[model samples]
Target: MPSCLTCIARKVKCDAPDSLSDCGNCRRLGEECRRHNPVPMVVSRQESKQFTRAGTKRRRSQISCLDCRKHKRKCNGELPCARCIRMKRECEYDTSHGKEGTFHHSYSVQAPVLSSIQTSPSQTSHTSSSAAGYQSGSVNSPYFQSDTSTQDLDPLAMFAKQCPLFPEKELMKSLVQQFFARIAPCRLFGFLHEPTFMMKIDQGYGGRFDEFLLLAAICAAATKVNHEANKQMWESGVEWARYVLQQLILDLNRISVTKLMTLVVLHEHEYRIGNQSSCFLITGLCTRYTHILQLNVEYDNDILCQNSSLTASEKESRRRLMWCCYVMDSFASSGVTHLQLIQENKIEIQLPMSDEHFLFERAIVTDLTPDTIDHRAYLVRLMSIRNRILNYVKRFDKDRDLWDPQSEYHSLLSSLQEWCNIIPENWNLNHTTIYARKSQGLLSPLIELWIFFHLCYLDLYRVVVPGLSPAMRPEIDAVQIAAPTDFLQSSQEACFNHAVKLTRLLEASIQHEKDGPLDDPNIIIGAHEAIRALVSYAKVASSRINDDTKQLLAELVDISVHHLRLTQKRIPTAILGLRRTVSIIKNSGLAYLNYTNLESDSDSDSSQERPGLEEQLNPLSQFSVAARGLSERHGKGTSSARVGSECSSSQKSMFDDDNLLSPGRDMFPTSLEGWLTSNQFGDFI
Candidate 1:
């Protein structure tokens, strides 16, 4: 059974004696093939690199340059290797150098100058040359730029002429600058008669070659003179403008935020101990996303409806972009943890990466730490995790329509269940045995929690709501994690509750600022909606428990309550008086409301006014409806309504039959929470 690999691989006869260094065919062929070590049929997938090391090193392709990726050839990966040097090409590394990647342009110096006064971008301050001019480590920013002034940025003028997206550079600059207006103003009170920055972003640079970064720099650098009265960032749409660069970010593989996150991970040492500014930038970006998305979701009646102002294709593109950013934030922050671990270490660090960190994380830790072990195991784990993620992504791509909860997203939750069953709980984070405690943090948990919540809400509760019927329900398999109290044990209940609470708090604090006060109505509203939904969800979720789930449920209750009171909501504060009322309603089946004040003010006509009697008023109310599930369990239509707003005359309230947020019959089965449970078939689906 003895064999020679070289001859077998070559399809030649293994004529040599089976010795470490005496293969006869190799000897005849003048090739050194003395060994025939058995290779494992399956690689661990973690030690992929080690497997390569066992074999001969891969030869560098004779070609060397970034473009080599597309050309069919081996890459020497050289600095202008023979091919590139011969062809007069610049050797480019594919590292994606983070946010700094976008601005780098390789201009052929001989291109003709435009025969007119050249125009500079409104965002001229962010020019690549200026970044290039900055001495490394001189400016604290991870991004380097030229010290050149805006007026000298003639490249933009030429950029317009040379690039397809930039015809009429002057007009483009003016438009981009004006677009900043909707985003720059102070306080947003929910409604704006003015066009928003998102409108411009959705419209203006659809395919424009980024002639605007230059003007953005100019605007960012200039005083807030006419820029809408120097509004505080969190005050209004300005945060949107500040992070407008992220418009480029919403893509699946957004190179910009990924790069910025890359820079943060790579240069963690510079900002780690206390990189307040970078921290501020990140906080703003996340806050903006939170507020922007909250607004987008809540605007059922406002002009602020989602990218609807854009064409159908644009709307879909923007939606995907936003979701991608949300998803990537999970991995990117996990990448940041590599940096955090450095300061946590008691010993001196000397590596570019925590051998445990991401490839992006490796960019930071390894730079700081000295080389040691091959870190083959960590690499394997990362690759395996990535592969599984790719599989999930593939599933999503295949069923794009069902990816959202309103559609059959719950069917996708089963995929997550498979993931839960398979996701690794252990990891090789460090070389040392003492400090290498096995754990995966932050990333996996966030992905798990949101997907789980969406499943529970979308699938199980869709059909049961009493008042509104969805016109159509996407076909999706149901999960058994219902709110009926019969599906789970009391002991394990806390696990589910804790998961939901953590997701809510995380969303609330996504853009939390350390120095700034938190008072924006939109931010407040976002936190309120998330918290209230989760809180209501927890209340109903408790129905699904057995005695076994008691402790877990109790612990979850503690955590959820602790966080609930920590937020700044006067409504919650004032309603704290209703604690007993709420507890009674939840347990004893009574809608809690103090109507004594109304009784005292009965003399007032408005105070005495009650819900108007329709042509037919159900004599039966909350209890009657609860027993039956609903007056009518089936839906009337694919009903969706904007919460907390005035409905237009033509449009009927999905829950107009009852006040769903309230516990009255009006708030019965059709209440959002009730709908989620009844229609979706419950049990975390």
Candidate 2:
């Protein structure tokens, strides 16, 4: 019997089974067990031809690539074979060179394969055989080690090691359900489809990395329900989110709607954690990526009208994502008028439809134009109004060539009033039924919409607000040299009245939140801004106002302050900023009264530089300076500066005889009259 090539090469005894084509040794080793003919002499061309005709046909080359050979594994004998592709390594076959059994030197660049020819076991050393996949010291590589391979580098496996048991298929499903039920009901989070999202999650770890990132984000958002049971889930969700982010960076560069939505989720998470700066940065990325994906553009129905074209779901998804992006970009960059990211006019996409229509991707709700709109449409309208308001405010900036407040103020006010007049019956602020709906969660979106509307309303007219504009900070060189003032009594009264309505709404919202889920950071911060505005108005107008007006402002301030102090723990950063501004105003108010009294009384030193009426009445002037210093101090680090940092010992000492609201102390003013007076005073004391 002819011995197999491998047995002959090793000089081992041939062991065969009569029933099997392959020899016993070769079969057991999973090697290509072909028989070899004995060497024959070639006397002449005619004799050689006769000998070749008589010889049996040898089997085709069945040898594996160099990598498989080194690992003692099976390989399909193709150039750049399956194993090479999976391992992400170069594949090379052995080629004949100058002599028999000699390989081309260049073949070593990729791990060179061994020739299929026979060789003695003594001649082929184990070191040389094993070195097929390596150079000197290459064994130190993790890939070269037996335990670690390309599979070990999988992000899912790495993520599994970090976040075990969480997002374990069933748990992830439940969390996703919770997200849709709780958070997704909000218009801002309506970007993803329930069925599609669930189907992707069903793909498990084998699914797209972007899908996993989205699921992780959903998990994080769902866990925001503020229950003790959800604490572990929140932490696990955060871990998984981090894992997804790490994996996303390593994965393909394809930017999909899923990635944009994931970023939005992460942005909200940052905002929830009071990381406004991070939120702004992430929103910018989301906006840029959204624009790149052309989600901001309307679906080309002319091209996509065919059967295989973009489906209703796809179009709706694009619209939803685009709208959400617009909302977030507008929301995050709302206060900083010049920093807005999305250009509203550049977007030509349709606003998202009703949740029912969008969710099922059905055309059942064909009456797109309506006198009264749904919550989603109402929100889009509000965003439009907000966009207009922001644009109007942008014109007030001194750097803008269009800085003409007198020309624009009436038109802007008219537009805002038109918006208020056109509010749908369902969204009417005065309707008790609407309040009932809000309590029942039927009008949940309106709660935020109202707050956002008021926030924008406040921002629009704040430039002309009486106490803060021309009369407030006239002494500061920057204030004087900065934007030109356009103080109007109508803008002033309108601003204060809006502040009153907003503060009332905020107080009610906070009180309502006592039994509901935790307030979002937006609501908290919006409320904080309202409080700051109210207190500033009161602080500036207190000395020149009547006792009744003083009491009214005082009540508003107290309620806002009470709600703020109650919810400060959940949103310490936001609460802390407002607290600092309030503390500064209070301290500065006290300083103003003391300085005035010092100048008036006979016991005072004549040489002392008494503060003028501007400083005495408008303590915000000093507060602004100290606040700038505080921002400079805190801007250097990630950790929060104390609320008292807004008013330093040096700042407070300028007003009060002592450090009234230092880090460890509460901001309780000793005298309401000293800190915040109600009675009107003449130009002279």
Candidate 3:
């Protein structure tokens, strides 16, 4: 039953009983008594067949386009398929199957066939048998056979065979857990999202070669934090991981984020092992890969829409990886422009989010480097500032004046102060704050962050303090101000204060090592720089400062040296650098009191024999004994006469060379400046 259109339009109820019947009101008015009867949809035979085929599922084409087949995408069975045209790839179909009367396409035998495709009964039976074999993990299955043929060729497989740890799933899992727990929290290694990475590990790395490589690298890094009992086992695993990663570098035909992550970890591992040259080369490789991948720029929303495979977490990881590369570049370049591969102006990617957001895979938008105070983002920002400082310091010869208010030096100094002002109060290094951060597993990163901040001040202010920075000594000497100006005095005072602060911070960090050892190699460099600044100031200010001030400076140097000795056990480069610094202090005739012995002696009231002040002030007279000791240890000639002759000649020509820090020279230099500007110190940095 339905209402007529005329009656309904007139706002009256219809009396029609069916859709085809006329209404009573229209019939009485002698108007057309029409009802709203929807006409039946008619179809031609061809159109009916098309409709039937659409509902039942039309058969797939007997062939696929070449481009579609290569990329494993769907084809529309047209001359040029939609995928091919959209991807801008050439499209061509194989017509040879048409002549065989049995249509066929070249596909992997493991690929499932569409149910609508027509196949011979024998083919159907063979496919069923193959499916059963595949399900059972039989070697006879084509997919399994193909995997077997290339199993030995895979680098990860070779690595697994070589790595004893990889075969022990439990041990491997322990090391992986150790890495994420200890090492991955550092800002440089924060690119990895633990939940996603752990999920992949629980699924056996999802059969990905890159994931396996990253896992191997993780195991190697974790070994750095391992105990001494397993040192040999850890070393073997590290060596195999390094070798396999080196080999994999040669086979990289495409760029991937996982591969970049592996290289980043391996770069840090290289630095930890004292291979600065390898670290430099690897950083360059990573920078090139980063550029090729365009990780420096955020993906356009349109591009992100087209690539459905990129998840929100993956996008965040890309941004983090980009920042990691920037950090590595900053360290490797160390302010040398020719070595700088990634420029800040070129970086358009957003800074990393907070660890909470990143680890939980939240897709929140974050501020850029200058705005964000998130731990990871702020670390990158500080790194950018440090890079600018280094570049300005390195190019001191070109700068007009360090004291000018409008100069680059003042600009960099202002930036450093601004950075310090923005630091949250909780970041302060005290016993209570240290313990609080330790409870949250953030003690190491907090210490490292402040260490880096102090290092920037050391590099900047040391340029004006004569004998402190070897690189700037000649340039500063050329200016030759007779009496120190207010600016120069302020710079010297700033340099000395920061050096003392750096030493104290390091001492505090070492005393509070209940959580773990400081893993960052840069900590060692910071300690060395602090010691250098303190010793240099002691030498120049010996006549001006009182005995108590001299003793205080000596204690600071001892504290820094103690830290170096402790770090030497973990980092090989630290051992050599520490020895050199010790030799320099002894030869320079600066007070080399042992801080721990001083404490014990004060309690026992036992007097320790100390070198006389006259001998300490005479730097040239004290060089022979220290030089001979170093020479004898290195298997060089131990004759005091030869050592004296070399010391005399070194003092005469120490400032003659332009590139004082050049490599491949004497392992033990005679003068304090020689030791400060030696290749050993340069390579350690």
User: How do the residues 1-685 of candidate 1 rate in per-residue lDDT, one tens digit apiece?
Assistant: 3556666656667766545555776666555563545454435422342233324223434323456666755565433334443453333433343665433222111112211111223222333212211111100111112222322344544333433233254444444443233221211100111132234334332211222332332233222222223333112222222332332233213222222222222112111112223333453354244333341232122222233333222222222223222322322222222111111122122211222232111222122122421222222223233323322321332443432444433444454454344333332111332123212212222222333333333222323221111111122112223323332233123333434554443333332322111211112222222333333434545465445444443344333343333332311221221232223224322122212321111111221122221101111111111222223433332232222123343234434433334454343335667656664422332
Q: How accurate is candidate 1 locally (lDDT)?
A: 0.30
Q: Among all windows of ten consecutive residues in candidate 2, which has the lowest summed lDDT?
A: 131-140
> Which residue pairs show collisions in model 3?
none
**Clashes in predicted model 2:** 1
**347-417, model 2: which lDDT tens digit per residue?**
87666776666666663222334431356666776777766665555335443322344556556666667
Top TM-score model: 3
Q: Is candidate 1 or 3 superior in TM-score?
A: 3
List per-prediction Cα lDDT, in the order shown.
0.30, 0.52, 0.60
Error of 1 at 462 (Å): 7.5
Candidate 1 TM-score over all chains jointly = 0.27
How do the residues 126-207 of candidate 3 rate in per-residue lDDT, one tens digit apiece?
2221110110110010211012222223333433653444645677788778777777767668777778666645644423
Q: Candidates' TM-scores?
A: 0.27, 0.61, 0.64
In model 3, the number of clashes is 0
TM-score of candidate 2 relative to the true fold: 0.61
